[model samples]
Target: MCGRFALTATLEVLAQMFDVPERPNLAPRWNIAPTQQTCVVTQDPSGRHLASMRWGFEGPNGAPLINARSETAAVKPSFRAALAERRCLVPADSFYEWQHLDEKRKQPWRIGMKGGTPFAFAGLWENATDKAGQPLQRFTILTCAANEYLAPLHERMPVIVAPEDYARWLAPGPAAGDLLRSFPDEPMARYRVSDRVNSVKHDDAGCFERLAATALL
Candidate 1:
């Protein structure tokens, strides 16, 4: 699942990339973690827009972090309603995944679009409110079995959306099943990076620098 990812592109770039108006005060995040406020693009009864959504699915005080499994999201209670009515496009420059190769040598990999174009992740969001009657929103990324290039590192990966399918995925109505497909393997590229990314505090461009395994950490 896309538990952690990067959104280093500018708002204008994202606006053009997603074809939506930028949300004022949208900051660029180098190491976005779950439960944090992150940007998402969606459509509603009014029109398409960009908005910030809390990463982890919000429920009770200790709601689980069960990011919807793309393979079964359409039927799951936590995501069914949102899947049908509140789909979104989660744009990311790249995502990190770790592979446990040996007892002490777990390697981290950064995956991005082949030519560095940003990609969209299929997501579901819900409108929830707190006891104080304040409005709150939460969302989760959908994941599916990993592609050949990623299977060796992790068994699953986020469902990356294709450019042509963006509108259909965010379009109002029954389009979940069709938009839930996995990204084509050809357009994806992967490589190893410094393990500094292993720490959430190490949020910088250096964290994304490619490095030899011997020099990592």
Candidate 2:
């Protein structure tokens, strides 16, 4: 599951990448945890727009819904409605995953495209009220079985929406469901990172610095 990730791209870069007109001043984030606010791209009658929404959804039982499995989301009550109407694209520079090597040893890895290019994850959003009695919009990333490159780290990863499929994903329909599959491993890369990323407080480029071979063990 994609419980933590990062989006350090500039607003201009994201705007161009997602083709949205709004120019919100979004700061770079390196430790985006679940339930925090982040940018998401969605479509409406007006056009595609970039907006901020909380990372997790409030399920019927009031628990945080951070991810929805692509294979079962259509049949899941918490995600079925949003899957049919409120699909979105979650922009990110890279994501973090933890690999357990032993009962007391786990390593955090940074995974991104081979060139560190920005990409979008297939997402779903919903509108609800917050504790402050104000309207709150939230979203959840979709997960699929891991590809070859990520299987060693975890059994699942976020569903990356290709550039060509962005339109179909935001459009209201079931055809876009086909895009929620594992991203190809060839274009992706991963490396072990410092354990500082284990804490949500450390939000900086250092969190992604590649750890030396001797440090990994």
Candidate 3:
């Protein structure tokens, strides 16, 4: 599951890519953890629009659901309506996953498409009320079984929507359900990165630094 990811693209670039007219007020973030405000694009009759939304679902169990298994999300009570009516595009340049090195240890790695291209993850969103009676909009990333190249790092990976299929994914239907499959291993790449990404407090570009160039703490 995508517990942490990065979105470092500029507002202008995201707007053009997603066909959004009004851009949200957001900066380049290199280490985005769950529950934090992150950028999401949703489609309406008026067309696609970019907005900032808090990551994860505010559930009745008092726990935030950050990632949903794409296989079962269509039928899951918490995600069914969102999947059918409130689908969103979670824009990110890359995402972080942990590689199990041994029984007790793991290494952090960064995964992205070749040439480090920007992409969007298939996601679901809904409106909810916060603890203090405040209105809130939240979203959750969709995940599926990992491809051959990513199985070593983790058994699952977020479902990334391609640029060409963005419109179909935003439209609610069985066709959108077909887009939840794993992204091919050919266009994707993974690399060892500094463990600085393990913390929510760090949000700078340094968090994406190659671990081989630096040292992991």
Please give the CA lDDT of all the candidate structures: 0.81, 0.91, 0.89
lDDT of 2 by residue, 1-217 (tens): 8989999999888888988999987988998998899999999989999999999999778888999999999999999999988899999989999999899999999989877899999999999889999999999999999998899899999999989889889886674767889999888878889899999899998998889863321
- In candidate 2, stretches whose alpha carbon ends up further than 4 angstroms from where it belongs are 213-217
In model 2, the Cα lDDT at residue 189 comes to: 78
Model 3: weakest 10-residue lDDT segment is: 208-217
Compare the candidates by lDDT and give the number of the best one: 2
Report the lDDT of model 3 for residue 141. 96
In terms of lDDT, the poorest run of 10 residues in model 2 is: 208-217
lDDT comparing candidate 1 with the true structure: 0.81
Ranking by TM-score: 2, 3, 1
Top candidate, metric TM-score: 2
Each model's TM-score? 0.90, 0.96, 0.95
Put down candidate 3 lDDT per residue, 111-166, tens digits, no spaces.
Answer: 89888789999999999877899998999999999989898889999999989999
Show model 1 residue runs off by greater than 4 Å: 59-66, 130-133, 213-217
Structure candidate 1, residue pairs in collision: none
